[model samples]
Target: MTSLERVSISIEKRLLTRLEKLIKSSRYTNRSEFIRDMIRSKLVEQDWANERREVIGTITLIYDHHRRELSEKLTDIQHDHHDEVLASTHVHIAHDRCAEMIMVKGRVDRVRALADRLHREKGVLHAELSMSATGDSLR
Candidate 1:
C-alpha cells in the first residue's frame, strides 16, 4: 500500500459548503476521498489530451442494419485499423436497428479518428466514445 499524506488548504466559506454538499450527494464518507477521485478524473482527461499517449476506450454505435452496405463498410474500417480494435460485440436492438460496442486501444489520435469515422457514416444514428486510461499512470 502507498503511504498516506495529509494536507490542508484554505477555501472560501461558500465553496467549502458546496464541497460538503457534493460529498454528501456523492455518498462519500469524507471530503478527502472525494477530492482524490476528482483529481484522478482530471488526470485521465490530461492523459487523453496528450496525443502520443496510449489510451484505452470504447466506441458505442447504434444504427440501422437495413442500410445498404453499412455493416460491410464499418467492418472494413475496423479491419483497416485492426491493430487498435481489441474486440467488438453486436446486438440486434429491433427488427431493423442494431447496436455495437467496440473496444479500442491506441494513441489518442487514432482512436479519435476511428470514432469520427464511425460517427460520420450515413446510417449511424448515434456514436459515443468513452475515453479511459490504460492504467499505467493511475497507480
Candidate 2:
C-alpha cells in the first residue's frame, strides 16, 4: 500500500457548504474520500491527454445494420485497427439496429482515432468512447 498523508485546506464558508452538499448528494461518506477520488479522476484524464500514453477504453456504437453495406464497412474498419482492439461484442437490438461494444488498448491518440473513424461512418446512430488509464501511475 502507498503511504497516506493528511492535510488541511481552507475555503470560504459558502464554498465549504456547497461542497458538503455535493458530497452528500454523491453519497460519499466523507470529504476527504470524495476529494481523493476527484483528484484521481483528473489524473486519469491527464494521463490520456499525452499521445504516447498507453490506455484502455471502450467504444460503444449503435447503428442501423440494414443500411447498405454498413455492417461490412464497420467490420472492415475494425479489422484495420486489429492491433488496438482487444475484443468486440455485437448484439442485434432490433430488426434493423445493432450495437457493438469494442474494448481497446493502445496509445491514446491511436485509440481516439479509431473511435473517431467508427463514429464518423455513415449509418451510425450514436457512438461513445469511455477513457481510462492502465494504472501505471495511480498506485
Candidate 3:
C-alpha cells in the first residue's frame, strides 16, 4: 500500500452537510475513500475528453432484431474496427428486441466514432456510451 498523507480543506457548512449526505447515500464507509474515488472519476473524464489519449469504455445498444439488415450493419461496423473492439456480448431481450454490449479500448476519438456509428443505425432503439479509464492514469 502507498503511504498516506493527511490534508485539510475548508468548506461552507451547507456544502459539508451535503457531502456527508452523499457519502451516506452512496454507502461509502468514510469521506476519505469517497473523495479518492471522486478524484479518480474526474481523472477518467479528463482522459476521455482528450481525444489522443487511450481510454477504455463500453457501448450498450438495444435494437429490433426484425429490422432488415440491421444486424448485418452492426456486425460490419464492429469488424471494421476490430482493433478497438475488445469483446462483445449479445442478448435476445424478447421476440423482436435484442441488446448488445461492446467493450472497447483505444484513442478516445476512435471509440467515440464506433459508438456513434452504432447509435446511428436505423433499428437502434437506444444506445449509451459508458466512459472509463485504462487504469494507467488512475494509479
| Best prediction by lDDT | 3
Scored against the true structure, residue 81 in model 1 reaches a CA lDDT of 91
Worst 10 residues of 3 by lDDT: 1-10
Per-residue lDDT over 39-63 for candidate 1, one digit per residue giving the tens place of the 0 to 100 score: 8888899999998999999999999
The 10-residue segment with the lowest total lDDT in model 1:
130-139
| lDDT at 32, model 1 | 89
Maximum-TM-score candidate: 3
lDDT preference between candidates 2 and 3, better one = 3
Ranking by TM-score: 3, 1, 2
Q: Which ten residues in a row are the worst by lDDT in model 2?
A: 130-139
Give a tens-digit lDDT track for model 3, residues 10-109: 9999999999999999999989999999999999999998999999999999999999999989999999999899999999999999999999999999
lDDT per residue (tens digit) for residues 1-139 in model 2: 7788999898999999999999999999988899998898998999887999999999999999889999889899999999899999999989989999999999998999999999999999999999888888666
| Model 2 error, position 125 (Å) | 0.9
**Better structure of 1 and 2 per TM-score:** 1
